[model samples]
Target: MTVAVGLFGYAVAMAFLAPRVLPRLTRHGVHPNLGVAAWLSVMTSVLGSWGTAVLIAVADAAHTWLHADRLVLSGLHEAEVIVTGHEGLAAQLALLLVTAVPAVLAVILFGRLARSQVRMRLRAREHADALRLTGTRMHRHSYADVVLLDSAERAAYCVAGSPNVVVVTSGAVAALRRRELAAVLAHEHAHLMRRHPLLLTVTRGLAATFARVSLFPVGAREVARLLEMSADDIAVRRHGREPLLSGLLALSGVAPAGALAASGADVLARAERLVSPRTRLRRIRAALLTGIGVAVLAPLLVVGAASGLLLCLI
Candidate 1:
C-alpha cells in the first residue's frame, strides 16, 4: 500500500510539475533543474517500488519468525474479523487498483507525448538542407555559418546539425547600419556557439515526456537572452557601445517576425540596461545567487532521497 502511495505521489508530481518547472528553469538560466527533476522522479518511483518489496519481505520474515502456529491462528481470527469488519481483500485490491491505474496512465500518456515530439524534431532535421535559401557572405563562426540572403520579408532562422547555419534576409541586412549588423551577426553566432536551439528542443522533448520536467524551455530562453547580451558585449567591445546602441535602436524600429532580428522587441530596454551603471553589479549578483541556490538545493535533494529510503525500510 505504501509503495502504491509513493508511485501515485510521484506520478502526480511529475504529471503536474514537469511542464511548468522546465519552462521556468529555462527562463531563469537554471540548467540543473531539469536533470534534478528527472532524477528525482525516477528515483522516487524506484524507491517506492523497492520500499514495497522490502515491506512485503519484512512481513514475510516476521511471519516466518512467528512460525506456522501463529499464522494459522491469526488467519482464522482474521477471517472471522473480516467477516464482521469493513476491511477485506477486496478493499485492498481496490485501493491498489485505484492508485496504480492512474500512475500507469500518467506515465504512458506523458511518455508517448515526449516520444512524438522527438520524432518530429528528428524529421524536421531531414529537410534542413533542402530549406536553404540563397545568400552571400556566409560568416563562418565557431557555432554556425551565418549567411545573408536577399528576401522580400525579413527573416532569421537557424538550421540544426553539424556546421549549423543561421540565415538572415536582405531586408534584415538593409535595416541596420554596419555596427548594428555586426551586433546582429554576433547574436546569431552566439546562439549557434551555445547550441541553444538543440538544447531547447531536447529539453522541450523531455519536458513533454514528464510533466514535471524543469529548466528546459525557460533555461533555453534565458540562455538565448544572455547569449544576446554576450554577443552585444562582443559587438560593443569591437565596435563601441554607441554603434551597438544605435544599431539596436535602428533595428528596433523595423524588427522582423519569426526571426531573431538585429532588433528584438526588448532592444531598447536591453540597450538602456546595458548603459545602466548597475548592470555589471546585477549580473554578478544574479550569478552569485544562482550558484548559491544550486549549492543549497543539491544537498537537500540528497537528504530527501536518504529519508525516502529510510521510510521504505521502516
Candidate 2:
C-alpha cells in the first residue's frame, strides 16, 4: 500500500507539472530533436508510473491474501486480528475491486492505441498504393523514390512505408526554381530518412487516445511543429536556407492523410526562423538534458524506494 501510494502520487504530480514546465523548457531556442525527446520521455514516464502502481497494488494484495493464514501467526498477527477480525477474504474482495478499475482502464487505453496505429498504417499504405498507381516514377533514389503526379496543384509530400515515396505535382515542378525544387526534395528526403512520419503517427495516437491528459495533446502538436523545424534544419544544411524558404513559399497544399508535406506544419514560423535563427546557450542546453534525465529516472527511483521500504517492513 505504501509503495502503491508513492507511485500513484509521483505519477499524478508529474502529469500535472509536465504540461506546465515542458513548454518553457523546450522552446524554439533548444534543438528540436531534444525537445521531441523530452516530450516523449514525459509521456512514457507518466503512463509507466501509473501502470506500475496498478500492478504493484494488485500484486501486493494477492501476496497478502495468499499469506494470510501464515501472517495470522507471524509478525503482523496482532495487527491483522485487531484490524480485520480475521475477515481477510472480505478485504481481499474489496482490494480486487480497487485494482480491477485501473487494470480495465489500462486495457481500454492499449486497445485504443493499437486501433489508432493500425488505422494510421493502413491509411498510409493505401495512400502509397494509390500514388504508385496514379503517379509516374520520376527518380529512383536510394532513400526514397520520387513520384510525379499530373495535377496542376503545387502539392509536394512524402508517403512513408516500404519503398518510401516523395510525391510532387506538375504545378510544383513548373513553379519551383531548380534550387527551390532541390531544397523541397531534400526536406521530404529528410522526413523519410529520419522516419518523421512514424514519430508523428505515435504522437497522434497518444493524443487521440489520451486527450484528457492535456500533456499528450499539446505534446502531439508541439512534436509535429518541432519535427518540421528539424527537417527544415536538415534541408538548410544540404541546400541552404534561401532555397528551402523559397520552396516553402512556392509550394501550397494540404498533405494527404498520414503523409508529410514539405509545406505542412507552421510554414510561417519556419520561414521566420530561417530568416533569423537563434542559438541556445550551452548552459541552457545542459540544463535541459539534466531535466530530461531527472524526469526519466524519478519514477524508477520512486518504485525502488517503495520496494526497499516494503522489504525492510517485512
Candidate 3:
C-alpha cells in the first residue's frame, strides 16, 4: 500500500512537471546561457522539487516494504518513515520539519520570482504602447516590429509587446539589400509569432533555479540555441536560403548586446544548414522521428520505470 501511494504521488508530480520541461527541451536545446540566469534559478527549484518528490516516494516505498507488518494504511507508514525514520514520533516529526520547510520555501520563492518576470514583461509591453509610431498596425498584439534606431551600433532587437517590435539600426539597414532585410524581418517575426520572449523568460527562471541547486545548466542553454534555429528556419522558409544567409553574414559584423541580431554566434552555421537541401531534409526527418518517439515512449517509459522501482522495493 505504501509503495502504491508513493507510485501515485510520483505519477502526479511527473504529470504536472514533465509537460512544462519537455516542451522547453524541444523548443530550445538543453544548454546554459548567460541571459536566462533568473529563470534558470526558478527552473532549478522546480527540478529540485521533482528530485525531492522522487526520492521521498522511493524511500517511502522501501520503508513500507521493510515494515510490511505495520497497519496497512496505504503509504502513510512510508510517509511517516520519511518524516520520522523507524524511531519514535519525535524523530519522525523532526525529519518532516527539516525536509518540508525547505521544500515549501523553495517552491514559494521560485514561483514568486517567475511571476515577477512575467509581470515585468507585461509592463514592458505597456511601456512599448507609448513608443508606437503612427500608421503602423503592428502594435495590435505582441508582434515584434522591425524598425531602425539612431544608435551608432548596428543591431537587431525585439522591443517585446502585443506587437512586439523588432528594431534594426540604420547601419544594419544600409548594409543589407531588400531581400536580406526581408529575411531579417522574417526571423524576428518568427520569434514574435512563437512568443519566444515568454518562453525564454520561463526558461531563464528554470536555469537560475537549477544553478542554485547545483543541477545541470546545459539544458536551458541548449533550448535557447534551438529556439534560435527554429526562428532561422522560419526565416529561411519565408525569404529563401540565400537572403537569410546573406543577412546572417552582414549582421554578424554588427550584432549588439540586448538585441536579437540576425547574424552572430551560430547564425552562419544555421544559414548554411538552411541553404543545404540535404541538411534540411535530414533535420526534418530527425525532428519528426524524435517527436514520434517521444510521443510514444514518454508515458510508457515514465510509468514503467516508476512502477518497476516500486515493485522492486516491495
Candidate 4:
C-alpha cells in the first residue's frame, strides 16, 4: 500500500502538477537559477522516494512470496495474505509492476547521464578542433582562455570542458567596437569562471532522463538563460552597460554546442533593463525563494503524508 501510494503520488505530480507550477514561478518573479534548483530538488526527491518504495516492495516479495508460501502479518500474526501463486493473478501483476518501474527508471537515468557526459566531451573536443584550425589564438582574457575565429558571422562563444576554449568570430571583431569586444570577451569569461557548462550539463542529464516531467525541461532552459543573464550582469560591472549592450546587439548568433554565446533571443527581453537597471523587488524575490523552498520540500511532504496515512490504515 505504501509503495502503491508513493508511486501514484510521484507519477501524478510529475506528469501533471509540476508543469502547472513551473510557469507560475516565473510569473511570481522567481529568479531563474533559484527556480531551476527548486525543480531539480523536487524531481530528484520524488524519484528517491519512489525508488525506496519499489525496493521495499521487491524485498517483501522476494522473502515472502518467492521464498515462503505465506506472509506473517506483524507481531500478532493474526491476519495474513497468501504470498505465492495461490494469490489472484491481479495481485501478482501488481507486485511485478510495483517492483519493476522504479528499477527501470533508475537504469534509464544512469544511461542518459553517461551518454550526456560522453556527448559533452565530444562536443568540447570538436569546438577545440574547429577553433584551432579556423581561428588564431588571441591574448588570453584575464579570467578565460581565448581564440579568435576568422569568420564573418558575429559570434563569440566559450566551451569550458577539459579542453576549455573561447572563440570570437572576426565578424564580431569588425562589427563591435573595441569596448564592445572587450565586454563580449568578459561575458564569455564569466561563463568559464562561473562553470556554467558543467551546470548546464547536469541539468541536461536531468532533462533527458525525466523528459516527461515539465520541471526538468523548464529548469534546464531556465538555467541556460539565467547563466547568460548572470554573465551579462558581470559584464555590466566590468565595463558598464553600453559596451555589453552593443556587443550583444552586434553578436546575436546561436552559440556552438558546449559553448555560451554572446547573444540569444532570450536576452532580447533584457534590453530594457540594460538601459535602466532596476533593483530586484524584495517581496517578489522573497516569494520566489519561498516557492523554491516549497518545491524542494514537496516530495518529502507527499511521501511522508502517504506513509503516515498508509500506516494508519494498515
lDDT on C-alpha atoms for all candidate structures: 0.51, 0.83, 0.56, 0.69
Best by TM-score: 2
How do the residues 1-314 of candidate 3 rate in per-residue lDDT, one tens digit apiece? 33334433544554355445544434322221222332343344344435555456545545644675552454456555544346777866665565556556656766876776776677667645644552233333236544556655555656566666676666777888999988887887787787766666665555555454322345445556666777777887888878878777777344432234466446655665566544244454454455445434444455567667756765
Quote the positional error of residue 57 for candidate 1 in Å.
16
- Model 1, 1-314: lDDT tens digits are 33334434543454345446433333332222333333334334433443443444445434533453453443444433333334777854554455455556655755785676677566545534434444664566676667766775554555564556677778767776776677666666655665545544554454445434343334334434544555566566677887767766655234322223445535655687568754344554454455445434533454466557756665
Model 3, 93: alpha-carbon shift in Å?
3.1
lDDT score for candidate 2 against the true structure = 0.83
Could you tell which candidate, 2 or 3, scores higher by TM-score? 2
The list of candidate 1 runs beyond 4 A from truth reads 1-86, 102-106, 116-120, 123-127, 133-139, 155-157, 203-227, 252-262, 279-314
Q: Which stretches of candidate 2 lie over 4 Å from their true place?
A: 70-93, 311-314
Per-residue C-alpha lDDT of model 4 across residues 195-237, encoded as one tens digit per residue: 8878877777778877866767777776677777778888889
Give candidate 4's TM-score.
0.83
Least well predicted 10-residue stretch by lDDT in candidate 1: 26-35
lDDT of 4: 0.69
**Per-model TM values vs. the true structure:** 0.58, 0.90, 0.63, 0.83
Q: Which residue pairs show backbone clashes in model 4?
A: none
